[model samples]
Target chain A: MNPQFIMDGLVAGAMIGLGAIGVTLTYSILRFANFAHGEFLSWGAYLALAVSGALGFLATGLTRPIAPFSFGWSLPLALVIAIFLTGLLALVLDAVLFARLRSRGSAVIILVMASFGASLALRSLLEFLFTSKPAYYTKALQIAVRLGGGLRATPDQLLSLGVTVVVVVVIHLLLTRTEIGRSMRAVSENPALAGIAGIDVRRVIRFVWFIGAGLACIAGTMTGLLVQIRPYLGHDLLLPLFSAAILGGIGSVPGAMIAGLIVGLSEAGAVQLVGAEWRSAVSFVILVLVLLLRPRGLFGRPA
Target chain B: MTGASPIPAAGAPALETRGLVAGYEPDLPIVRGVDLSVASGELLVLLGPNGAGKSTLVKAIAGVVPIHAGTVSIGGRDITALPAHRKIGAGLAFVPQTENIFATLSIQENLQIAAAVLPKARRAERIAAMYAQFPDLAVKPARLAGSLSGGQRQMLAIARALMVDPPVLILDEPSAGLSPKIVADVFSMLTEINRAGVTVVLVEQNVKAALAIASRAIILVEGRIGHEGAAQDLLDDPILARLYLGTGQAMEARRP
Candidate 1:
């Protein structure tokens, strides 16, 4: 009967939804579930933190709060740099790891296993760089704003939801309207055919890595802002990310977003009802049930 | 080429390859040392037994397969070093044997991706041209290509290839899985395309249907051209039997 669960669910859902877009896209185009995708979130969050810390030191005025928002101009600027750096990281990872494997005609299983290795390497590197200590974007406190029906959310939380909507809508339009986005879909559909049709397969791959990791960066920044950042932050959410991606269907952007919310709600509801220990089980249960009943998922054919 | 008329390079073969050897791996050359020339505005059908490199030869020419050694030219343009994506701009278009269309995409999306290589102003006009040619697709541009009938899928694939109005269009096994009536429709469509001055190189298993519309035919055996002549000259029993059964030369070479 508590409305607190709704707020918790939505905030987590937005983060998971954004993260799941990267997972689904890598899986669809690259033909592998990139376990390293989760590490991008950790790297992104830490990168933004490092940049914000430096920027705040350079120009103390940047740290001033942007109205009701907890963080200010520094954080936004840091997010931009973090997105670019994260995107570059994704591309380098693919070039050094995945692209080499593809050239050698590696099997999907090998690619998946290689991604597991990448995930470990990335996470270990992140831990060594930033340590395992929990970090936050801001220490400023926020009071919850009230809405109708006993609902309440912080300005940051509302921003997260609004941003997710904008990201999803923009991505949808890109896929449908833009030449590059349509080429991405074309490559995902039939890579060889896309190449023969005059689509630069490598360029599409680069774009995917950039876009996928950029989205991951946004999700990571939001997570750091909302909760506390830890080395295992993305690791902890891996299951929910995969669940949201698969439950929404493999390649559908809107599906992943909606599915993220569903997974978030389920986990939140489960934590409230059966204690937090059962929260992880919620996503797994939903994944199993969906695969059992609707194998293609809500939007499996892709957008 | 999409907005303006297609003009084949005068006095140049539509597509040409010399000393071509290609396959998935560098050491295993499925298409070995093929010297081929297709004249402008010709419908040349490639016929061969299984593993004779019929598909591999076309794929190598298209830059889809890894070439161990080769030179491929389109309308006198040297495109041997070009990547597969750039070949379309060089006046050569290739439609793969399978997975030819973007199955998850709508008919319009598939055409749009094909036309993406065209100029912005010419893209819509090219797509409209495709729709005009293939009425089956025009009726439902928004429909998913995967759900289309086998015949319709082939039409869409051909249409996608024609979107750029390439001087040379190479198709690998365009008649592999289609029904007889559908095969006729596809062959007739190719004939129409060839008549419009597009050079077509089709690899086909349906010998009778393919030769019906083709002007010339080449039979490949063990990665080498074993026979070449007028299309009508190939319909005889000896050639058709040679198509299904390999030349005894390979067996003789294998004997200790």
Candidate 2:
């Protein structure tokens, strides 16, 4: 086995894992697979692109890389802005569309369909604004340091993975050590009961969108840092993100993270063994196999 | 029974709902034109046959079901427009019949979520108090609520409702599907809890067991209140059961 594929998969998986966390959360709390979640990633990338460009005029030093990493100071600043903006966008969309439909007791199918429509509208808007061309943050390349066993990774990749770990740890603490997280879990388990218990269902929903979208924003920014940014950046990762989320268990956060790495490695392995063309198909195959075998996924409670 | 009620001599009713008309959808009111008042520190048992709108009535009072018409007051404070979640902060807690506890959350977390609105310093004391009240829950605080037995779940549900230390608690059929022994245990627990100064309004089908502890009882026949007042009074009058079960008009007409 070529160790390089494993290295590539680890980096790619870290990004997907971050994305899948949001997907799993929305599925768990909102009880629907939000097709428009991918667009939040798209929004994150584009918003960063725009912000980084504007900040270039404000501080010339911010545009420069912070040594050993591909990302510039402006990019980090851009990420913070992007996270809030994307989270706000998610809230606005929910307020305008999903929340009202939910209050009226719309079925899951209706919400899913509305999400599909939301995805199209969002994707089209991104395309209309950014055009079909690809964009970049720094256009500078970093030197890859050799780890061992003939494998090497750039500092950017390593940083992305480090950030992923920190984000995951923060989320774990939030869910386990805090009241809001406990309330979120309660709402996910049983909304009616949670409501009667005095957990504000609407507030929980709002917080979920904020956390989920904020995480996706970081993931998208990392992806843009690793590769080139495009309007379809999030569109390309949607299938694999869902695959990881489902394979991990619909509502389990840690399950989604581990599943993401597995999916990413599998896709990378497919690219090496079968062909790059077969890479995307690997996730769908895993999704089908999981559904056929362990339909509840690894960590999901049996429904 | 139809007019505005006189103010009770002892302070105010813990819970009062007047002309409450609500249901799941428009043009289909399950609980129509109902009035109820439970005095402070009283255990009011709401009895009726299945589909007599007993659960619907409690749900409307709890703010789970939207009231199409009428007012609901907790401790003389109008809370008809408050949503279900806000009711707890307003000194009202509701324990739903099914899915009353957070099934996926651990027993400890279920209590934590219930007391989320409390000050941080008081949360641990509140949880410890719940465990002390229900010794069964204390042993398995880490266990998922879904894994608990039917009787344990009911206890956990009641414990979760009590987490807020609410003055008024509304339970919708807490003992719906349990063994006779478990039913007796649950009713005894309710009696003890009510004694602890939490006014309770319980909707029950177990008439004999419910009346054993209830200070007052309201029997609903269809969407209307067919009988109300002292629990023993309703229990002693055999015609009340006939009226409640809607067995025959002859038994209802014979009521003195």
Candidate 3:
């Protein structure tokens, strides 16, 4: 097994892990699998692409890659724009579709179907606007920095890994240390009791959408930085993301992150063993094996 | 305990339902033309057979079930049209018979969620007050509500309700499925709470125990009030007890 191949797997695994956290959070809190979550990733990436393109048009001189870790107009600025835009898009989607359905007492399965419809609409919208062409943010890809043991990683991959860690940590703190987070847990456990307890269930639900969608956006944009951006980028990653969430246990954030890493590394290793053709099948295999054996996944609490 | 001075009528009733009619399905009222009240600082136990709409009546009052007819007022304010949260905001607390606690949350967190309607600055103090009231809860404040025994969970449920400091607390069979000792402890707590001037409306199948703590009692047959009077009067009267409280055969005989 080449160490470089392992590094490749780890980098990819990190991105999947980040995406999986959002899926798991939404699933646990909303009690539904949001099929449209994938669109947020695509949306986030496109948001970054659009912003970067607009800035580029303003002044070709401004289009120069910023110093330190460059992708033109500073990575931080680009990420902030991407996250905000993606978060806003998620909120709008909820307001327009999911929220109304929820009020009408729509079943969970109906909500799931609505998410599918939403995904199709968002995906098509992206395709119509951006075309099917693959795009990149930076003209110059950063040189790979080699670590010992035949492993090499680019600065973007390193930055993504760092970002994933920060996001996961912040989420962990939010869930454990904050009032809204506690309310979220309460609502997830028993919504009626939470309502009687005076928790604004609707507000907590909105927050869940924002956080889940926002994370998906970050994951989507990061993946774009690592690879090429396309409208189907998130769709392609959806199965793997879902697998990560299920593997971690539906509502467990830490479980989702760990499961995501497992899926990432496993897919990476599968490619090494069976070639790239088998890469897509890895998540399915893990999902099936877990469902057959554990059913609860690695960290899922018994229902 | 009949005619035990009435305690000078202690302000208006905490909850009053006049000709209330409610049910899950439209055109089939589970609670039919029921009129009842629980005076402030009083404990009123509502007893009935399994399908007699005891739970439905309270649910309607709490705004959990839609009232098809009549009015529900809390402290002289008409709240028949209020939603569940608004009803809670109006100082009405309901502890359901089952799934009453947020199982995954800690005892402290459960109380915190209950105090969510209160301003942030006051929640901590309210929680502290609850812990003080139930010092047993203080020892395991960090324990998950799910991990507690059935009795402890009931206590936590009651404690969560008290977090809002509601003037009226409604308990739907707080003693259900608990050991006799636990039931005794719960009744004692109810008495203590009543002494502290919180109005209590209790729905119980434990006729003897419920009557012992209740200042007033109502017996329901089908959806209508079969009997309403002093707790001790119903407890002592053989004909009334055998009719409405015992076997429920007499109560069923009078159903039509």
Per-residue lDDT of B4-102 in model 3, one digit per residue for the tens? 112223466778999999998769999999988777778999997778999999888887788999998877778899777666777888999999998
TM-score of chain A, model 2? 0.98
Query: Candidate 2, after superposition: displacement of residue B223 in Å?
Result: 1.0
lDDT string, candidate 1, B129-169, tens digits: 89999999999899999999989999999999899888888
Tell me the spans in candidate 3 whose CA falls farther than 4 Å from its real position.
A59-62, A68-70, B1-11, B247-256
Sorted into a CAPRI-style docking class, model 1 comes out as high
Q: For model 2, how does the per-residue alpha-carbon lDDT over A21-54 read when each residue is reduced to its tens digit? A: 9999988999998999988888899898899989
**TM-score of every candidate:** 0.93, 0.95, 0.93
Question: Which candidate should be chosen as best, given TM-score against the real structure?
Answer: 2
* lDDT value, residue A211 of candidate 2: 92
Q: Write the per-residue lDDT of candidate 2 for residues B1-256, one digit (tens) a residue.
A: 1011223235778888899898998689989999888888899998877777899999988888878999999878888988888888888888888888888888988888876777788889888988998999999789998899999999999988888788888898888899989988988998888887878999987777888899999888777797888988877776776667433433333222
Give the poorly placed runs of model 2, Cα more than 4 Å off.
Answer: B1-10, B245-256
Reproduced native contacts, each prediction: 0.96, 0.98, 0.60
Instruction: State which candidate, 1 or 3, has the greater DockQ.
Output: 1
Can you list each candidate's DockQ? 0.82, 0.79, 0.60
Poorest 10 consecutive residues by lDDT, candidate 2 chain B: B1-10
Evaluated against the true structure, the overall lDDT of model 3 is 0.85
Candidate 3 reaches a DockQ of: 0.60
lDDT for predicted candidate 1 compared with the true structure: 0.87
